[model samples]
Target: MDLNQRITAFSNLSLFLKNFLSDATKCEATLNDFEHLKEELQQVIQTANRHNAWFTPEHITQALSSWSAALQKDNLTTWLDAYAITSSSEKRVAVIMAGNLPLVGFHDFLSVLITGHHLVAKLSSDDQLLMPFLARVLIIIEPGFDSKITFTKEKLPQFDAVIATGSNNTARYFEYYFKNKPSIIRKNRNAVAVLTGNETPQQLEALGDDIFGYFGMGCRSVAKLYVPQNYDFDTFFQAMFKQQDVINHHKYANNYDYNKAVYLMSLFPVLDNGFMVLKEDTNFSSPISVVFYERYTDVETLKAELQSKADQIQCIVADDFSDEDVAFGQAQNPKLYDYADGVDTVAFLLKL
Candidate 1:
């Protein structure tokens, strides 16, 4: 498809989803629609069956709600930027996805669809089935999308760009592989949190959404807490403990065991939840339920610390948005305009 054709499709898609938005909101159908995501939900679970890809019915409900809300603009002028289909187009895009959470590949899908680009996606072994099923669903929803998108198994052919998400260690490998191309390479990223003294139980629940959703496998999931030195971790634990059924899932239990054993061998002090472990390491990505922490004197110091780790952190879930912080869980549920790596994918598509 030409750039014009691609943009037209995206524009139409925005409108179509927008129409469903109202229906979704009215009937709580968005949450209901997650059942639609379940048949293939196990694909990710199967991939993570050995790891921690437990997709609880509640999580699926939450994911669909988030996905619907994401279709609407929280505050973006364009849905995405069409970077690949410029005058000089990027022909074949090798996309590396993070299997940490379901639909972790949504940004990549938008990047490919809006840009009128071809994607050579290497499915994270931990998250293989959802994206393709979603693509098929979208193609059915809008027949126009069928001809433009295709998925592949082989290494990508030479192309204009490569968008890859990986650890800091693998970044060098991607750079060496795609040096001459226009690429957006994502390094190890963790989400952080700042706690104020007056958090309602509702906000605490939201924090649970951020941390435990997907069993803390997502980069957007909080792996560290910047609480006051005297803050009671017990309050947070009690709130998270409400997810007892979540704590019961076997897939998550497996990761919990693996992570706990590692910590035990390392002689690490960990906060225990029958199956999961919460630690105080500074690592951005946690294996299963283990997360890290640092005590902040106050919100101001916490914000400053977050800024210092800006490149490594995706978003900071703070009660206060002063100095430009985002809402809790917003990082995990990104609006369509929220581009990965600050790249305006839909706008690029529109201009094309």
Candidate 2:
């Protein structure tokens, strides 16, 4: 199938997903031939929660909603407009997905297929169901996709290129294994918010979404905070209180209790607001239910430091900070063009 056909199929899949957001039963009528798949998708969502405790129904729905918003025809067209999608040589691209969040490696999956290449996806054990199910939906929308997608748990066969996402240690293995092939191997990275102590309560509440969404599991989740020196915690804590409902999830609450116990036992200084913990630390990757913070003496100096450590960061959340920085609460809602790790997946695939 051609680019327009692929885009139309994905756009239809997006519409199908929109119906499944809150109540799949209510939206089943909207589905065309995939009406039967609605019940199946609902079961997958239910089973996903059992397979991965972090994949709560609410979190999975949030992920579905994000994809639904992203896969609009206009959004897809605008994102693909910048790239020349002329390559007809279809190469098999192996994708090793990460399972930190729902559909975490979907962008790569989408990129490989949308670029007219075949995909050999090795699904993350933590996220084994969702993508393959979506692949089925895509095939129903565009039957040609059946021959283009493959999911295997065994060793990947020879392929023209590879895209892998994993922790830093696993990235080393990916680099070594795929040395002969074109590759984009990603490593662990965290997002941080730069606080000027001037944000309104609404902004801070939105910032809470950046911090607590997906229970701070995704790389785009704000794991660290860079606040002005002597910044009062009262306002920040008050604003974040709106997200206290996150603690109601048993998995998140367990992490909160365990991390807090460890901190208290160690006599480490921490600010607690019942649902989450804020601790001063230099690390960007914070434990679940905890947010690490650091004091910045000046914006210029902090900006320079952050720039120097760009490779270690996935996103920077700030207001009027820089053209590259994501706005408060907008980190998780990255657009199609917002390439992860600053690497263009489409460009890489087109070249292959």
Candidate 3:
């Protein structure tokens, strides 16, 4: 299929996903091949919770909604407008996906296909179902895509280039394994929020979404706080209380209880809001149920420190903090053009 055909197929997949958001059981008339794909997708959604507790129905729905919003015809056209996409000799591109959040590696999948490359994806065990199911929808929408997609549990076959995502440790292994090939090896990165002690309650409340969304498992989740020295915790805690319902999740609550007990036993001072814990720490990556916080004496000094350690940061969120800074509540809602780790996936694929 040509570029326009590929775009139309993905846009159709987005429409199929949008139908399932409100009521997956009630098949919509607009869906093509509605009966078969609808039944399969519904079953996947119904059992996703059983496979991974983090894939709660609400979280899965939110992920689907985000993709639906992103896959609009206008959005896709605008994002791809900057690139000169030409049909070329197709090469196989292997993608090693991360399962930290639902559909986390989809951008890579979309990039490879849209750039006229075949995809050989090794699905993360935690997120094995969704992508492949979506692939099936695409194949049905455009039979030409069937030859372009592959999923495997065994060792990956020879491919021209690779894109892999994992922890810093696994990244080193990928770097060595894929050394002979062109690749993008992603490492662990965390997002942080810089609090000036002037944010209104509304902004702080939105920041809570950045911190607690996806139960704070995704890389874009705000894991640390850079606050002015002597910043009071009362306002922050009160604003975060809006998301107190997170504590009801057994997995999150278990972490909160265990981490709190461990901290208390060690005699480390911590601020708790029943659902979340804040501790004075210089580190960027914090444990689940806990957000590390460090006090900054001056904004300029803090900016320099962050610039020096840019590799460890995925996003810096604040009000006009910098050109790259994400606003409160937008950390998890990145647009199509917001490349991860400042690496351009489309450019990488096009070069291959």
Which residues of candidate 1, in runs, are more than 4 Å off? Answer: 1-65, 72-90, 261-267, 346-352
Name the runs in model 2 displaced over 4 angstroms.
22-31
Which 10 consecutive positions of candidate 1 have the poorest summed lDDT?
A: 22-31
- Candidate 3, run of 10 with poorest lDDT: 23-32
RMSD of every candidate to native, in Å, equals 5.3, 1.7, 1.6
lDDT score at residue 320, model 2, on the 0-100 scale: 84
Instruction: Report clash pairs, candidate 3.
Output: none
Instruction: Say which prediction, candidate 1 or candidate 3, comes out ahead on TM-score.
Output: 3
Q: What C-alpha lDDT, on a 0 to 100 scale, does residue 324 get in candidate 2?
A: 85
- Model 1, range 223-297, lDDT digits (tens) per residue? 777777787777777777766666577777777788888888989888886755778766666676677777667
TM-score of each: 0.77, 0.97, 0.97
lDDT of 2 by residue, 1-352 (tens): 8899999888888888887665555443245655578788889999999999999988888999999999989999999999888858899999999999999988898899999999999999999999999998888778999999999999998788999999999999999988999999999999999999999998999999999999999999999999999899999999998898998899999999999999999999999999999999998899999999999998889999999999989999988887887888899999999998999999989887
Tally clashing residue pairs in candidate 2: 0
lDDT of 3 at 75: 85
